[model samples]
Target: MAFKLPVHCPSCETMLSVSQLSCPECSTVVSGNYDLPLFLQLTRDEQDFIMQFILNSGSLKEMAAQMGNSYPTVRNKLDDIIGKINQLKNKNGKDDD
Candidate 1:
């Protein structure tokens, strides 16, 4: 099963859907798809990889050594995650237009 984050309304104490954008304060139901924050959206494995990468000071070689993975594997995972983040950012920007 895919993981999902819980959202809540600040005004009515109601559980909100991930697509929600407005609270009862505005008396409006915001429309369209909503995405989770980038850090939260990442899978556990990706998050772990990122944490290790950061601890290694952006050194892919060190990350590979620490994770017992090849340099290419680490690089590919980083690239994939970065691409996802960029895509999400672009999508959000387009939505705002």
Candidate 2:
């Protein structure tokens, strides 16, 4: 067996594959070439929420419907995910500089 990184879902604690773009349960991107943290930092629900948000083109209404959640809830989750991405970007930028 090939060596695999020990990545797990932050929410459900599910094992994640390094080649997976999104978590099987949460739909969060777990692996990539980008110099950033793993997606497992976020909960499975958060990961799933983000994947749906992106797929819906950042439409909260669509995400809410897909997730069976209220619009505000979906929006809040998106905001949180975006904030994390921003933080990662800032950190990476600082590292490069």
Top candidate by TM-score = 1
Model 2 lDDT at residue 52: 72
Residue lDDT tens for model 1, 1-97: 9755544457985534466667778688877765556565556777787888888999999988877999999899999998876775685564331
Query: Which regions of candidate 2 fall more than 4 Å away from where they truly are?
Result: 1-47, 94-97
- What's the CA RMSD for each of the models? 8.8, 9.8
TM-score of 2: 0.48
| Residue lDDT tens for model 2, 28-64 | 7755544325465455676777677678887889878
Q: Model-by-model lDDT, in order?
A: 0.73, 0.65
